[model samples]
Structures are given as structure tokens and as C-alpha cells.
Target chain A: MLLNQFLLLSALLFAMGVYGVLTRRNGVLVLMSVELILNAVNINLVAFGAFQDNVQGDVFAIFVIAVAAAEVGVGLAMVLLMYRNRRSIDFTEVDLMKG
Target chain B: MTSALLLAQVEFDVAQNIAFAIIAAIMLISAFKMVTTGNVVHAALYLVIVLAASAAIFILLGSDFVGATQVLVYIGAIIVLFLFGIMLTKAQLGDDDSVEKEQRSMGALVGLLLFVVMAFALIDTFGTQEIEFGNPEPIAYVAEPVDANDLPTPVREALNISANSGTVEISEAQFATLLPEVQRRVPGAEVRGNNAQIADAIFSQYIIPFEAVSVLLLAALIGAVVVARKE
Candidate 1:
């Protein structure tokens, strides 16, 4: 029962995250959506770990959290630099790489 | 009819269900807001609520370690990093009057489709199975009982008669008799087994991954510094 609930919730969260990533124009919001996707993955890991009577899933979740922290650290710094140079966080505005 | 009876029985344990339902609702609602809210700070705050609720759910699932780690790592560190990003990026503090409604509708459609597919998959895989989480059986080991003189016996008797028997026979009577002796030898080792066994596996067997995580953190720190450094 709990496992199903977890699966449902994780799926929902993941879907919302995907939509956010796909549609959002703000770079910071996109990063936040990525965080949501990472979190959904963590939930699935912990839920399956509990169901299987194994700690490996939990350990993997911890690793995911660590990776997420690192991602946010570098990602945010880049966003900051972009905003500083371009004076805007909108993805449409920063198309210097396109030309 | 039988399902109704089971539902009634579950109703008596409303405390557990209530917390689960509330947290699940909060998580879903905040996730929805995260995508819909144009204000970056508000979205980050909503994400914090989602993370905290998920952590609460982890605790309810008997994973205390994972729950605490989630709280510490996600809520404490990751959200703080997000806020720092918002601050450093000089995001407009006021209302974002520029979000395109057409994009939002398109995103909603995609999100809805993804949800339907995932829901179907979950139902296909786990819908028929019943969730069962009875209390775990206690671990038992044979050891010589200390005499009244506080002296340990040299030759330990194999109280585990099932192990000795070729047929692997163990009666309830034998288990009842052996239980006290097992408890004495392994003090505080109740029905849950050795919790420390997890720590042992992590430090001994999975030491490489643990060290690699530290290295990853170091690299991230350096990268953040490099990115943030003034030109």
C-alpha cells in the first residue's frame, strides 16, 4: 500500500518536473525543476529499498542527494554569472551561443 | 464486503493514515505550485515544503537515517544553494508579469500525459500485490551462558538443534527455550537484528563510493568558486 502510494507520488513529481524543465524559460526555475526530478528519483529509491529489505537503495539515494547538491552549487554559480553579464535570467535572451 | 471490513479496520488507525495523506497532499500541491509559480523564490520555497514532506514520509516508513539525511542534505544544503542562486542572479523580486500562458498550457498537457503513463505503469506492476510489513523476526545466535560464578563455559552447546538435525526441525517449544539464552548472549539484539550491520557494510564494503562522494563534493566546491570568481 505504502509502496504504491510512493510510486504514484514519485511519478507525479517526476512528471511535473519534466514539464517545468521543458516549458520554463527562466534558467533558475529550470534548475529547480531538475531538483524536483532528482527528488522523485530519490523517493523511488528509498521506497524500493524498504520494500526489498535492503539498504542499497537508501545508500544510492544518499549519493543522489550528494550529486544534487554539487549540481545546484555549480548550476547556480553559472546562472549568477549569466545574469551578471546579460542582466537577465531569461533563457531566450542569452542566445550568444546560437550565433 | 471483505474490502469494506478491511477499510473499517484501517479507519481505527486514522493517525497513521492522516499523516500520510496530509504529507502526500502537501507534496503534490507544492510540486504543482513549483511549476506554476512565476516567482523563483516562491518556487524554491514550495520545493522546500516538498522536500520536508518527503523527509517526513521517509521517517514514517522506518528509515530514520535516510529521513534525517534527506532533511540535512536536501532542505538544509540544496535549498540554501537555490536561495543563494536566486540572490546572486539578481532575479526580479517583484511579480513576474511576463510568463507566457500558452507555454504553461503546453507544459500542463505534457505533465498530464506523463502522469497518466506512469500511473498506468505503477498499477500494472504493483496494483495486484498486497503491501505487507509485519514486524521483522529477531536475530538469534548460540553462545555459552555465563555461570553464576561469572565464568564462561569452554565448550558451547549448540542450542540450535535445527542446525544439528538433518531434517532442519525446530519446534515452537525449542524456540521458546532457546530465546532467553540467545537474548543473554547478544544483549539488546532484539527482533530487529544488528542495525550496525548497515554501517559496517558502508565503511568496509562500500568505502570506495563513500570516498568518491567526498571527492565529488570537493570538485563541486572548486567549480562553484571558479564560476563565482570576479573577472
Candidate 2:
């Protein structure tokens, strides 16, 4: 397959993720969008890795996945806190120190 | 055994492209629904589909190990975490329905701009470069297991394979010239990453970063437990 296809797909997916992050009111939904963005990055890395016949792309993809997992863990912990104290996952209402 | 560039041409693209099309369609739909679905659980399920499709793409590209890790980590662990978060949160999202709708148009506009720029750049810069990966077959034409130690010093060093690595890949033409007493061409699967090379890379060039990642994962694990602990 042409490299363009994969690149275009990642780009489109990334845009959707951007939209999700910007529009989602629910905090979990926003996090989900972030996952979309991360996955798009992964596709790009893997595609480029395959394209260049280098294993470094795969290595970076692995690292990105590891970091993303940690990020989601920490992110969800924060989300849990938000839900606990606020009783709502609507991030727009999270103005505890917005002064 | 007669060994003279044993060749069978395999048509590489037809079914592969079709499969890619079908899988990519499923992925795109799931990704769209994931971000747009109002129900949190439904959104998570959509994410599962999207992630699984991503795994399929990875496998299609011959990075099976990466694909498997994607399924296990993203779908298995991360989505489960999202589900747990959903179940724990009261998730009262209706109070600001109007606000969600209002912001969505602006989001759409920005998303469109990003897409346009990205797609244009991609299509223009990499118009038709085919993904070059995975040799058609491994070169093994030795009548017997060619011991890495037995090969002459120069050839051994040139092959750069240690005796213990077991799996050796060298072009029959190349190998014949270097160590001419070879027998048959071993024709089978392509010589791409099947986790072995990835392991090699991780342990060799990326050792420090791999160790650092493990430490980071540990930190995240402890931090998660501590933060979730009630005061």
C-alpha cells in the first residue's frame, strides 16, 4: 500500500480526536479522545517505521504505548478525584482555582 | 537436494489491499462513534473496536508483536480502566447538553482545518511511495545447518550473526559466494520482525530507555494506588 493512505488515515483520525478533545463535556470522553490522538501517533510511527525499513519506529511505538498507559493511569486517577469531590465529570465545571 | 534460486512468485497486494480497506473502514467508523457516542459505556465499547482495528493494522503491516501489545495494553488494560472510571463516576452529563452542542461546531471547524492541512501535506509529500517492508523470504540454502563459527572469519563477521542467535538469514547468492558449499534454498515466510529483532533492539540499543520505562511504570502504579487511597 502507498504510504499516503496510512498517513491520510492517521491525519483524519487525529482530526477527529482533536474534535473530541475540544467538544466533549464528560471528562472520560475527553480522555477517550486523547487516546484517539495517541493511537493516531502510533499509526504514524508504525507506518513510517515500515516505510523506512527501520526498527526504531517500532521501538518508539512501543515506548509511546508504555507512556500512554502510564498517562492514562495518572489521568484516570485525576478523573477519579474530580468525580469524588465534584460529583460530576463535566470538566467545564472544574474551576476550583480558576481565579 | 537441488538448490538454484528456488522461486515462486506470490501476488502480494490484491487480498491484502481488500482486507486493509475493510478493516480501515471498521476502524474509522468505530473511532467516529467512540468520540460522538453520548453513552459512556457505548463510547468505551467503540474505543475497544477502534483499538482492536488498530491491532489488525499493525499485524497487517507485519509487526505482530506490536499489534498484540496494542490489544493487550490498549484494549485490555486501558479500556478496562476507562470502564472502571465510568462505573465509579456519577456521570451526570445532561445538565450541560446545550453547552456540549454549542462547542461541537467550533470543534468541527477546527478539526476540519487540521484534517485539510494534514491530508494535503501527506498526500503531496508522500504521493505514492509504497511501504517497503519485509523481505519475501529468508535466505537459507545450506544443505546442513551452517554453523556460524564454521564460516570463515570475514564471512562470519560480515553476516554479523553470533553462533547462538540460531536463526540466520543471508541471501543465497551472497552466501554461495562467501561459503560456496551450500545446498538448498529455504523458501518460506518473509524475514520481518517477529518479536526477536524487537527484543534484540530493546536489549541492545534501547536498554537504558527500556529500564527507565519499567521504573516509570512502577512509579505510575504506586502513584495510582496512593492517589486512589481515601484520606
Candidate 3:
């Protein structure tokens, strides 16, 4: 497969993720968007690694996956905490820091 | 060397293109649904499909280990955590259809802009460049002792080396200087499989980062526990 095809896929996924993060009211959905972005990045990394003959890209992807796991773990926990405190996970509703 | 081999390569390329197209479509559609679905649970499930398709794409890219890790970590652990979070948060899992109507058009416009910029950049940089199959050539300027046992199965087979073949130390500089002579006497050097080389890289060159990631994971685990636990 062409590298550009993978790149295009990554770009589209990233855009979708961005849209999700920007517009989604639910905090959990926001985290899912972030996961989408990260997954797109993983595709880019693995594709480049495979095409360019570099194992570093794959190694970095491993780290990315681990980090993403941790991120989602913490993110979901935060969402849970927010829900416990506010009884709602909507981003607009949880705006206590609003000036 | 024969027309049969050439035909096989062409068929392989066609198969790869078809796989890429189908997987890309699946990932894009599911990702779109993941963001736009009214039910948070359904969105998460769509994310699972997207992630699973991504893992398939990784497998197609020949990084089998990374693909497996994606499935294990992303689908198995991360999405499940998202589901648990949704359930704990009492998110309306039903088709209430109030996911998000606020700022939808603005977000889509921004996303479209970003996509255009990224697509242009990507096309400008790597237009229609296909990823070559088979093994990647060895890294330059690194002297490594190679043994048949140390070689990956594909590489060993390609090099036609026995299991007990003695170690041969070859540096990039030495290879370059002796290229013409070596080419006359021997076939090309064996290129290790992605899994083998990745293992070598992580344990050798990237060991510190690997350890650091472990520490990071531990900290995240503890931090998540502390944050989510009720007082």
C-alpha cells in the first residue's frame, strides 16, 4: 500500500477526533476523541516505520500505546470523579472555573 | 526472476491496496460514528470497531507485534475503561439523541480546515509513494555481530544460513568499502523481521525509555486510584 494512503487515513481520523473533542458535551466522549487522535498517530508511526525501514517508529508506537492506556485510565477516572461530584459529565455543565 | 514471481508481486500489491481501502473505510466510518453517535455506549462501540480496524491496518503494515499490542491495549483495556467510565457516570446509554448539538457546525468547519491543511501537507510531501515490501536494509554506520541464530526466521531463510552459522561482524563502513567485492562473492545481507528488530531496538537502544514508561504506568495507576476513590 502507498504511504500516502495511510497518511490520508490518519489525517481523516485526526480530523474526526478534533471534531469530536471540539463539539462533544460529554467528557467521556471527549476522551474517546483523544483516543481517536492517538490511534491515528499510531497508524502514522507504524506506517512510516514499515515504509522507511526504521524500527524506532514501531518502538515509539509501543510507548505511544502505553502512554495512551495511561491517559485513558486517568481521563476516565477523572470523568468518573466529575460525575460523582457534579452528577453530570457534560462539559458545559461542569464549568466551575468559568470567569 | 521469473514472470511467475513478478505476477505474484503484482497480485500481492493489489491485495494490499484492496485491504488498505477496506480497512481505511471501516476506520473512517466508525470514527465518524464514534464522534457523532447519540448513545455514548454506541459511540464507544464504534470506537472499538475503529480501533480493531486500525489494528488490522497495522498488521497489513507488517508490524504484527504493534498490531497485537494495539488490540490488547486499545481495545481490551482502554475502550473497556471508557465503557466503565460511562456506566459509572450514569451516562444516558439509550438513544436519547442529545449527544451534542452545540458548536457542531463550527467544529466541523474547523475540522475540515485542519483536514485540508494536513491533507495538502501530506500529499505535497509523499504523493503516491508506495511502501516497499520485503526487508528494509540495515542501518548505516552500526557495527553489529550477526549470527544465524540471532537472525529472524525470514532473514535466516533468505540468507540460507544454518542455525549454527558462526557470528560475522559487519560494520556499515566495512560493508560500504567492501560492497563491490562482497557483491561479487555473496548475495545481499539478511534483513531481520520487524518483530526481531523491534525487540533488539527496545531492549538495547530504547531500554531506558521502556523502563521510564513502566514507571509512568505505575504512577498513572496509583494516581487514578487516588483520584477516583471516594473519600
Measured by lDDT, the strongest candidate is 3
lDDT of 2 by residue, B1-231 (tens): 223332221235766788889989999999888877777788889999989998999888878888999999998899999999888886753333545566889999999999999988888888899997656334345444555555555565555667666545556565556432222222231333357778889999999999999999999999988887799
lDDT per residue for candidate 1 within B1-231, as digits (tens), equals 999988976884476668888999999999999887878899999999999988987776666777898899889888888888888777876666465778778888988899999999898888855345444555554333333222212112434232223333333444456545454443222444324555766788889998998999999999999987888
Tens-digit lDDT string for candidate 3 (B147-182): 657655544444456779788654455455544324
Residue A47 lDDT (model 2): 90
lDDT of 2 by residue, A1-99 (tens): 788888888898999999999988788889999999999999999999889877787888999999999999988998898888878788888877998
User: How many angstroms is residue B202 displaced in model 3 relative to the true structure, after the best TM-score fit?
Assistant: 0.8
- Model 2 - which docking category? medium
Q: Best candidate per TM-score, number?
A: 3
**Candidate 1, residue B19: how far the Cα is off, in Å:** 2.5
Better model by lDDT: candidate 1 vs candidate 2: 2
lDDT of 3 by residue, A3-37 (tens): 99898999999999999998888899999999999
Error of 3 at B24 (Å): 1.1
What's the DockQ for every one of the candidates? Answer: 0.62, 0.79, 0.80
- Worst-scoring 10-residue span by lDDT in model 3 chain B: B179-188
Predicted structure 2, TM vs. truth: 0.81
Q: Rank candidates by lDDT, best first.
A: 3, 2, 1
Q: Which runs of model 2 end up more than 4 angstroms from their true locations? A: A97-99, B1-11, B92-98, B136-193
Candidate 3: Cα lDDT at B35: 85
